[model samples]
Every structure is written in C-alpha cells, then in structure tokens.
Target: MPPKSNDIEAGQAIKRLPSNAELVPHAGKITMDEPAYFGKGIIKDLKTTVGTHWRQEMTNFNQKTVAVSMLMFITVIAPTLAFGASYSTATESHIGAIETILATAWIGCAYSFIGGMPLCIIGSTGPVLAFTTVLYDMSKNMDIPFYTFYAWVSVWMLIYAFLCSFFDLTRFVRLATRFTDDIFAFLIVSIFVIKAIGDPFGGVDGILFPFDPNHKTHQNQDADYDFLQVALLGVILGFGTTWLIFYLRSFKNSSFFCSDTMRSSIHDFSVTFSVLIWTIVSKVIFKDVEVASLNVPDQFEPTYQCCDDACTMFFPKECPDQAERAGVRSWFADMADTNGKGWVPIAAAGPAVLAFFLLYLDNGITWHLIMHKSNNVHHGEAYNYDLLLSGCFNFVNGLLGLPWLVATTVPCIVHLNSLAEKDKDGNILHVQETRLTMLFSHMCVGFSILALDLLKLLPLPVLNGVFLFMGVSALPGIQFWNRFLLFFQQPSKYPETPYTKYMDKGRIHLFTIIELFFFAMVFVVQNIKAVAVVFPMMTFFCIPARTHLLPRIFEGWELVLLDGDIFEIQEWIDRKTDSVAEYEASLRGDLSEYEDDATQ
Candidate 1:
C-alpha cells in the first residue's frame, strides 16, 4: 500500500520511510557486507548449472557420447598437428606432435571431467606460442639456459593467475563486448583462411609468415613441378579438405542420403573422413610429394635440450655420444643451474608479468566466447576456478619440460557444435555435454604414436584445408563481418539484424570501422617481432574505446542495436518500430488534409 500524503508529511518530520515499491532494509544486517566468495565465486557457478536439473544434462550425454567422441578426435588432431609444429618453430622447443597430442589429452580430459565449463578444450594456442618465442630469444641473448628461465617465468605466471582468481579479476572479462570479440575471432579465422589459399590464391605458401629453410623438402622433383604447381596443389588440397568436411556436416539438413543416426555420425566424423581421403591422395597420387608431414619422433622419446631446432631430445648438437647413443631419455628439465644464479629466478618476474596478462586475457576471453548466452552454454562458468587450474597445469608442464597449455578456441567450438542437438532454425536445443567425448578423443591422441609411420602419412595441406574450413565456418557467427557485408549489399535486401532495423547505415559502418582498426592493429603487432609479445594486451584497448569513445557519437538506442546484449537489442527493436509506426501515421494524416484542401 502507498503511504498517505499526510502520513508521509508526518514521517518526514521524524524519518522518511520507503513506500511499497521500494525495498526497505531491516535494522540488523542479514548477510555479509561483501560476499565471501566475491572473487572466488564457486557458488554462483553452481547456480548456473547445478541449479538446473542434472538428469537432463545426463540424458543428452548418453544420447550423443559415441558421435561426439568421433568429432572431438577429428578436431583435436587437425589443430594438434598444425599448432604443435608451429609452436616448435616459435619457441625453439621440440614439443612435437606426440608431446602436443599427449598434452591435449591430459589437459582436455582433466578439464572435461573437472572443469566448471565443460565446453572448453584446453591446449596450446597461437598467441601464447608467439609470445613464448619472444622469451626463447631473450633467454638465449641473456646467456640464461632456456628451460631454467622458462621455469621461473612459468612460476611467476602461475602466481599471477592465482592472484587473479583470488581477487575475482576474471569478472572484468564481461567488459569485452562484441566489439573486441568479433575482432579476435575474425583475426584468427582470417589466419586459417589465408593460410589455406595464399593471400591472392595464386602466390607461394607464404601467406603472412615466410617459409623456413628446414621446412619439408619437396618429393615431387621427379614430377618437375615448379613453384606455381606446388602452390596450386596446396590450394587445391586445402580447399578440398575444407569443402568435404562442410559437405558431410551439412547432411543433417539434406532431404535424402540422411537419417537422424546417419546425420549424427556424419557430423561427428566428417573432419577425420575428409582428412583421410586427402592423405591418401598426397601419398599415392603425389607419391610422398614435398608436402609437410607431422614431425613425429622415430620412437617413443622425451625431449632434451639442444642448439638446433630439429635435434632429438637425448642428444645435443655436439654430444660426445652422438654416434653411439643409447635410447634413454629424461622428461624433466634441470633447474639447478638457475638455482645458483638465483638472479635468473628473480629477473623472471618481469617477463612473467607480461606472460601472465597474455594467458589471463586470452584464456578469459575464450571462456566468455564459449559460454556466451548465444552459445547456449547451460553449465555454470568457473572463470576463477579454471584460471587456477590452468596455472597449475602450466606450472607442472614447466617442471616436466613440456609446453604450457591454454584454452584453444577453434577446437572447443568444433567439439560443442558436433554434440549440440539443434532445431530447424539452427539454435541449440541443448548441448550433449559429457566428459566421454573429450576423454576418449584425448586417449586416441595419447596412443597415436602406436601408428607412428602411418600417422606421418597425412600431408600438411589437408590440415590447411581444415584451417580454411574453420575460418569460413566461423564467419556466419561474427556480426562485424555481417555488418561489413551490408556496405556492398543493397539496403532494401539487407539481412535483418537488430542493427539493420534500429541503427542508421552511417552509425553501423562507423562501428565496424572501429572493430577493423583493432583487428588490423593486433594483426600488425602479432606479425612484428619486436612488439608481438604484447599482441593480446594490445587488443584490450578496444574495450575502453567501446565504452568511452564510441558512445560520444551514437545514442543509447543506436549503440544498443549496434553492440548491446541480446535483451537490450530486442528492447531497442520494439521501441524503434513503435516510433516509426507513429511517425508514418502522423505523416498520413497531414497528407490527407493537404489533399482535401487542394481539392476544395
């Protein structure tokens, strides 16, 4: 009930009491002034998932396990093969396919079974790999042993991650709106696309990074193929792999040659199926042609230190036992050398701080992308928990002389889409979230060396094809690219999004221009050796630019339509349509009056 005016007046003399609509505080405090887990919010996580019924999540899990596992295997293998090789070159660390595959299995399975967000797949990623290269160069220049300096850096990184989790700093990730995420997504997707087909679709293999001398030697010398032929063949096989995967994945919507069960299996195994076909073509037709092969170890062996990138772990570049070496190996790196220098451990804090931010931002942003409501992530987010786990994982890897792991973006999405049961309009009905897919897929990777020679039979171009397909596949989800398309499109035939309805053309284009600026800057920084170590941090500038700068030009309504969350965008749409209808009606009324007056 409302307080009477006289009653309010009377109360004003003594105290003003809140009315019915207002929430009144009691005399005594009922809860803590600050939440105990404000920074380490695990209970909030439970509310996101455990609050929802568990039985239904389990039901979806049972229905899709076998199919999802197959999909996971394909997605895991492609990136593991591509990224592992790249990481080796960047860091000068021989974390070859076997090491990369094993790390993926260990981290993926652990995260799947224990992680708060089941959708995320943990592995090595491009940004971290690039950043590690900077450290490797620094260690060599400073006369510090690479592994010892790296261990100290990893320890510092772990400390930073722990502090972030404790302080609840992961919540800041919410500030990275569509403006930043779209740029990062498109940047990565662009890498995959350009790598498959050369920038012009006719140039040599060097899309952005040039070819290394140690790169696979050509096997097509007998065929007398020139530069153009090899480049063209790479383009052909790459696109072929990409298209084949897409064709099989799209079978779910086909009118024929498709049943629900068949569609499920096809979607799950499409990537692996496409890769196998292309591998045979490279081996039989090309006859072991100069295409890149995964540099697997000759036998089961752990890595050891060496000056050369290609040196096997057990032997250094000039080992005394180089010729008469036994097959024994050591997995853990020796940190005792640094234990005496002591300054190396302390100095590590400087680089560690930079590495910390790189890991934190990259890992957190990827989490937000996978868990975005649009993705229909039913499980709760464990941002704090996962950050801590990732730190621990990397710290252990440091001890083991293994490469650090982080959340990989493309593989995670592939895993989710493979298991997601969608409706006719293509929105997720529910994800078949389970550990089995990740666990089983990783197990396959751990034992991959069992088929060592056969595994090396797969050509690198096929992986490039997977890369191209992933980039093309991701384009549909990015609004920045969609808005950019409107520039070349007819206004009358423009696709309907919240912005197309409420925001003006000039405003939307300006929004896209800002995103492009950030994307371009990050790309430049990533390719430039001097500043590339801070590439992920450079992307953070987009957030403040969106919050403070862009609003100066666009109104609240326009901004919401252009880059707001789902509910805000929908609200703007409804309000704008009503305003448009009112204006049209008033204009009609005036036109009719003018017509009558002229007739009179």
Candidate 2:
C-alpha cells in the first residue's frame, strides 16, 4: 500500500513495496554458485576502466595537435639552436656551446618529461643563459677551469633542491597575484628583448661605431660581416618560428585535436623545427660562417681514465685536492667559498633566495590562471605539491652548477587547457589523466638527448623565427585601450566573479602594455636595464597617488560607483558582516515593509 503524502512528510512512511524489495534487498546470503558472475563483473570493470579513460584523453590530446607540437619544437629545439649560436659567437668556440646544449638537453628531458606541470618547456632560460655567459666571461678573465666549476655548482644545487622538496616550500604560491606574475613576465620579456636586440649590436657603445664611414673595412670586415649575417639570420628565423606556432594554435574548437594536448605540442614543435632547421642550414650554407660545434675535450680522457674499457675518475678530478684548483672562477665557487677558504664571488645567498622566490611566485600565478581556464581541472591545492617537484628539479640543476630552471607561463597554461574536457555546465573534466603522455614525452626527450650528433644538425634561423613568434603571441595580453581607460578614469565595466563584487583585470592588462612598451624601448634605444629603475619608481608613485588623492576627490557615494557599483558594494559588505554584528539590526526590514505596502 502507498503511504499518504502527509504521513511520508511527517516521518510515518510506509514499508517498501514487493517490487522495490526485489530490486534492492537489505541483506544477501552469498552462494558458491554466484561467485563466477560477481568475479566476471569485477574483472570487466577493471579491464575497461583504463581503456575507457585513455581513449577520451588521447582524442583530447590530439585536437590541437599541430599547435602543441609547434610549441614543443619552439620550447626545446629553438633554444637549442640559439644557445649553440650564442656560445659560439661569444666565446669563438663551438665546443662549449655544444657541451652546454648536451648537458642542458640531458637535464631538460627530465624537466620537460617527468615534470608534473605540463607545457613547461625546459631548456636554457634567459637568466640561466645570462648566468652561463657570466660564468664563461669570469672563467676567461680569471683564467679558471670551466667544467670543474660547473660540476661543483651542480652538486650543491642538487642538495638545495632536495631540501626545498623535503620542507614543502611551494605553499607560498597562494599569495602570488596577477601583479607578481606580470612583474616577472614583464621582466622575462624585457630580458629576452634585451638579449635578442643587444646580442646583434654587441652592447650600447658598439652599435654605430663599426658601421661608421671613417672606419677601416679591412680590419673589421670579417667580424662585422659575420655579426650582421648571424644577427639577421637568427632574428628572422626565431621570430618566424614563434609566430607560426601561435598562429596554428589559435584555431581552437570544442572537438577533438583542438584540445590542449596537440595545440601545445604543435606550438613546441613549430619552435623546435624552426630552430633545428636553421641550425642545420647554417652549417651547410656558411661553412665559413664560423658557427659553433659541441665537440670538446672528452670528460673521460683528461678528467678520467679508462679502467676495463669504462670511464672512471683517476684522481683529483671530480673533487680536486689543494687550494690552487679549488677556487677557480667556475659556477661552483660559491660552494667552495662558503667554507671561508675560496675565491672572491658576487652577491651570494640573498640574490639567489630572492631570485628563487620571485621565480616561484611568477610561475605559480600564471599557471593558476591558465589552469583555471581548462574544462576538466584540479583545484589549486595540488599546485603546492607540483611546484615542490619543480623546485626540487631546479635545485638539482643548480647543484650541477647548472642554471636554475623555471616553469614558463604560456606553454604550461596552453598545454593543460588544450588537454582538458568540460562537463555540461562547462566545468573542467578529468585533468590528472594527461600524466601518461607527459611521461612518454619525457622518456623520448631523455633518449633523444643522448644522440648529440643528431641534435647538432639543427639550425639557428628557424629557432629565431620561433622566438619571435612566442614574443609576438604574448602581445594580445597587452589590451592597451582597456588599460588606458582603467588607469585614467573610473572603470565603466569591471570584471566580476561570483564571490567578489569587483575584480581587477587592469593589473594584467597594464602590465602587458608596460612589458611590450619596455620591449620596444629596449629594441629601439638599446638600453633596457635603465627602464627597470623607472618601473619600480612609477609603480610606487602611481599606487600611492591614486589611493590617497582619488578617494578624497570623490564623495563616499561616488566612491562606491568608482570602486564597483553601489548595490554590489553594499551587498558584499552586508554579507561579510552577517555573522559579526554586536547588536541585532534589521536594515532590510524597512525595505520589505515598503515592498509589502506597494503590493497592497
């Protein structure tokens, strides 16, 4: 019999029907005959679980396949070409460039592949490259052994990285706002522009001097001609490659292959192919182009001895004994100098600590924003864990006396979002599932790096094309007009999320404009570092100037509109104070009475 509606609601519900009892029983008695059927069902589910998920993920991964491939190429291959060229150009030795490339590639494979944050292409970054250049210069000036110092620094960096992971230091990423990310990104773009533009000109003083009419052509002919040729070729290729990747990836869709996986991969590949091809072509066309090669003194022969047909350190090689060899101006001098018995060094612990923290904040914020765009995604809680892994990797690289690595902004975001799926409400679906492909890619990179000869065949121009593309791709983020209006006047339209009445997209928009403007200044004026000082000062003045003066100029009621909207502001304040009022008050009671009277 059916229960009355009142009885059901009042908690006097009737017993289950006979049909319902058949469908679901309170208890069951296990029978030996039923074991086979239950076992089959369990086995079937287990077998199908991985298979079902994998198909969807692969389909998603391939959607934006071309773009993803291009990004990978740009991230990995383009830098490989640039590093080789830069080292050769700077040192007049191809071997150093080659060795660094080999080492970086070997390490980068682990970073690019095993790293938890997908789309972060690992290789020689701008700062790390700059540091390497510094190391090289210091080595030349001080007459110190290069490889030994490198090894020493590498060992210590590993120790530092391990400590970072053990302590779980990635928790600080939560405070990082769009402001911090933009600052770092602005800096990164500035650095890239500086290096790209400055490298060709050879610094501030040398730009017009060599090209002056009165200069003797015989003395400077080879050097000037070579510099111009390399510069022109590299710029065209790097920029072109970067552009192609961005162009291909922009054609996003809800269907398969347009998703995160392929889009990012294609973008990487475009960069890689651009760079790699240029390198190969450079070698072929300008045999006298005097480009660099990686062949160097074998690590095993001079530093180690062959024992039973395998390399083994003979003596005083890995860790040299006595003071004379220890203090050489290599990257590892910091470690030896720490004990109070080594050579003169630059800013020690403070700069490195600050640099690491800045890098963490910069990467974490950008990653969070990009990750949020994905349909299927994990919450930011896992960011700490992932960042810990990245930091650990960086620390390990540092110990190798290698350059400290970082998680890049664009690639990481593009990779994850392209791979994500969305539910009916447009919420992101399963994201953690992309781990399989990431693992496979890492394995590929690791094995590929061992073939140093094949890697050397890559060209520089293609890489340049890719570099230019990446820089150009970031331009859209600038939002110049939108930023200008927000900066000068009260925002007519403001971004809003459900929890907050108003959100500031202006920070990012302004930062991007500032970054592009800085890049342009560096390109044109050729003295970018001068702007760094200017930026901090401007930020200081603008923030204070607006906060204090703007409030006074506008009335309290006007201020509400200026900040957001009056109703929205009041609603937020009321909700926040709902639990905190000392005295009970019915502020909305009067309004409710008016509404009731109006209805009557």
Candidate 3:
C-alpha cells in the first residue's frame, strides 16, 4: 500500500536538515575559528571588519538615515546632558556637559570611521557614573587630585584593554546568554521609565510636572502665573509627545492613510516630528507659561569656572575678580599632580582593574545583545576591535579629564531599532546599517555647544516623553518581558511560542522566576551606592549561573526551549528527534530477538 500524503510530507521534512553554514552560533557558545591567544583573533576580526568599514557608511544611504539621524541626535543628546549633569555633581564639575559633548563627538566620529560595530551607540552609563562617584570620594579621602589619579588609572586601563584585545579575551562574551541580556536591557528600560515619571504624584522635581507646590502667591504676582496651569501644560506636552509618536508610528498600518509611503515616512520621522512640534508648543504657543527647559551651558567652556592660577591640585582657590575662569584647566590632565604621593600611579592599578572589568562587561554584553540573530544585523561583529577602540577613547577621555564612555544599552537599542526596517508584525526585515546616523547625530551634538541657547528652548518634559517612548518601544522585542507578561495571561490563551508549545506552563514560569531573581539582585546591588562598583562583576556572574546552575534545575531540552535563540532551538529539536529514533529502533531489535526465541 502507498504511504499517505501526510506521511510523505513528514518524511520529506525530516530529510531536509539545515546546512552547517546556515546555522547561527548560539550566544552561549564560542564558535569562532581564530586562535584565542596572541594577535591571530584580532587579525581574523579585522579581515572582515576592516573590509566592510566603508561600505557600511557609503551604501544604503537613504531618507531613513536622515530621519534616524535627527531622532538619534535627540536621543543621544538628552542622555548626554543628563549624565553630564550627574557627573558634575558626582565629580565636582570636572567632567561636565562640555566635556561629555566633546568626548561623544570626537569618539563617536572616530568610531564611525573605524569601529567594528557602528550601530552601537557609545555613552556614559549609570554604573560608570556610580563608579566615578566612588572614585571621587576615594580621591578626596586620599587627598589626591581626582583627575590626575583618574588619568593614571585610565593609562593602566588602556594597557589592559589592548592586552585583552590581543589575547581575544572578549570571546568569553559568548557565554552571555539571553538570561543576562534580558535582565540588563530591562534594567536600562527601568531607568528610562523612572527618570521620565519621577514622583509624578507630588514631587516638585518631577520631570513630567515640575511645579513647586510650596510657592505662595503674592498680591503683586501676575494672576496669569498659575503653577497649576504650568504643571498641567507640561504634562500635556510630555504625554502629548509620547502619544503623537506612537500614533504616527501606528499610522503606517492605519486605513486613513492614502499612501503607504506617506504613512511610512510619517512613522519614520515620528520622533523628530514629535520633538519639533512639542518644542514649538512649549516655546511659541504657550510662551506665557514658564516650563523647565533643557539645562545647557551658556558658552562653549569648561563647567568648573576658575582662573588658571587660582585653583591648586588639592584645594581650589577663589577665582581672581573679573577674570575669565572657563580655561582654568588645560586640555591635558596632570598625572604628576598627585599631592606628592609617589605611590599614586602604582596604586591606581587597583581601580583600573575594576574599571577594566566594568568596561569589558558593559561593552561585551551590549554588543552580544545587538548582534543577536533576531535583530537581522548582517554586518559582522567586532568585539575585540570595539573593545580596543573603547579603551583607546576612554584613555584619551580620562587624560582630558572627561567622564568615561561605554556602549550605553538604551541608546544602542534605540539606535538599532530606529534603523531597522520592520514589517507590520514588527519582525526586522533588515537594518539600514550605516555610519551616517551616528556620525551625523554626534556632529550635531558637537555643534549644539554653539547653539546652547536654541537647545534651551526645548522643554525638559518633552525629553521625558522621549525617554518614556524609548523605554516602552524597546519592551516589545524582549523575550523575557514577553514571558513576564505571560504570568498575568491565561494559559489557555497564552501566545504559542516554542517554550509554550513544548514545555510545561509551570516550568516556563519557574525559568522566568529564576531570571527575575537575578535581575532583582543586579538591580538592588546597582541601587546601593556602597556596593554598586561591583555592578559589572555581578552582571558577569549571570554567565556561570546560566551555564552551570541552570542545567541542574531544568533539563537540557527545557533550557534550550526557554533560553536559546532560534537557531539553538532548532538544533536542539533535531537532536531530540534523532535520539528518539535510535531509542525506538533498539526497542524493535529487542522485540524481534524475543519473537525469534519464542518461535524456536
């Protein structure tokens, strides 16, 4: 009798295995052919990396790049200013807005031309900020010049970075499973969300409605100057910006749009359009109301204004009356000004070691997430090369007394998503991989120093909305977040992912619970200033927990189902099928032997 149609189809499907070349290396596995020691790995990386360096920028230049550039300009600048302000408080204005802008511009420009992954946006992060604050406190306690000690630490860090790159130590980044990436990504998203709507219920310093509740109205005060009206208008602008962007983004699929191209254009330029519209609304339409604007420097100068001869290494002296204090510090940091402590340079290595690990984990994990198979980024990764570049840039930044920069998680995710070409269902078809957006956006940041007045017109609430949008937009693609939402969902109506289809519901929730625990630990540690310098080390610990500890709790197949990428899941399924076939064949042989003995 002939086989049934379904049987034939199943047989054909079983015969069709994916080619070896088609398999994507699992995130938790190291599959590179280059030798780990010496410079061979770097050489191999550069062969693919250097060749495509120019093509990434020159090819695929389009209108989307321009829109993305403007969008990213706002995205990158807002955080730069925000972090810069934090640094001013943390480091006593040594690394302020101008320093951050300069570092971002110069480093961004250099990396665009030479970086292995141009899409990864480099900026200062919270962990780095926390570490800097700790280092400053240490410097004060030791009675040493902060910038001088900072410069020596960076010098040692540079050496360590080069050595790591040379030895291909960055290959360990492959051990960062989705478990780690999701937690890190979520942490960044949480930061954005919190910063956007800080104590919106009552706090006067809230970003959404920063009206002082303590203000008492005087008889001479203008009746039009109502704090309630100002607060309400600010809320409108903030939420209005977020709503407009999301509405326009959805307009591409809306039936009201006449042309698909027009709808798509509006969607692509949604962020830029929203920002411009809200800025005009705040500055022009509601000119009478005083909303908080972006705090930018009035001139292109150092934030710590002091006359050159007035300030000493240990104690800052009062500035001379009527003298320009902007150029007090020189471009180069004085490493020798260590308050007569000859052992300072040698002792700097201790902090340098911590900074190295911090940068390594920060840069490595972010690159791994960005290069994940789902993102559809075809451009090759340059983990070793990019690390080297970061070390080099940070070395320069440190010498110039600027805050250290690394691959900022939120901004990089935002940049990647912005350039991605997605379908109606939000699957990435292609990312418009280009250097132009990073190059252009950062250049605008550099130029903004001259146009600080223009930037001041942009209300802080509008940026808060942008921050809210960024955090919300990034949430859709995170698998952990999707699984997290499943906790609230009915099992019968659960979305049918591989894990859902194969694994038990209880098992799925257990895996999520474990991941949540790790995330919570990292979050708690990061918030506690006394132990926050260990943030990167704690983040790196997830690798061992995923690789060694997770296996004991879940079966191999279950782990693959829950945490593995698309390719890993497919491979695991194939292996399981083969094992089942072999087991069934052995049972048939045993049964045949028993039947022969019975016949005898």
Best by TM-score: 3
Q: What's the TM-score of each model vs. the native?
A: 0.81, 0.51, 0.87
After superposition, candidate 1 runs with Cα above 4 Å error: 1-39, 46-59, 62-64, 90-95, 198-216, 219-233, 283-292, 305-316, 326-329, 421-429, 575-600
- Give per-residue CA lDDT, model 3, range 1-600, as digits (tens): 633323433223122333322333342342443446787666766767767556746566788888899998899888888888878877877778888888888888788878888899988887888888988888989999888989998999999999999999998876787888898899878877777876332232345444555532212456566777777887898888889999989887888768988887998899999999998998899988888778787788666655555355212435445434444566788888888999999999999999999999999999999988878887788888788889999999999988899998888999999888787667788888889888888899888888888888889889999988999899987888999999999999998777898778999999999999999999888777788878878888998898889877876667777777777887866655654554343433333443365599
Candidate 3 regions off by >4 Å?
1-35, 199-206, 209-225, 307-310, 313-327, 573-600
Model 2 TM-score (2 dp): 0.51
- Candidate 3 minimal-lDDT segment of 10 residues: 13-22
lDDT of 1 by residue, 1-600 (tens): 634324423123212233211221221111222332545364555456544534444355553676567666756776776666666665554455556766777777776655667677777776677677778888778877677788788899898888887777776775777777787777767766775655442232432222333223443355464545555566667778888999998886786564787776777678778988888887788873466665565665654444334333434445765564444335665666663576897899998888888888878878877776666666677787788888988888776656778877776766776677778655667776665677777777777757677767767677767767777877777788888898899988988776776457887888788778889898888767677768778777777777778777666556666666665555555545544554343433333443465599
The RMSD of every model to the true structure, in order and in angstroms, is 9.8, 15.8, 6.5
Task: State the TM-score for model 1.
Answer: 0.81
The candidate 1 region of ten consecutive residues with least summed lDDT is: 21-30
**Which candidate ranks first by lDDT, i.e. highest?**
3
Report lDDT per candidate: 0.67, 0.41, 0.80
Report how far residue 547 has shifted in candidate 2, in Å.
Answer: 12
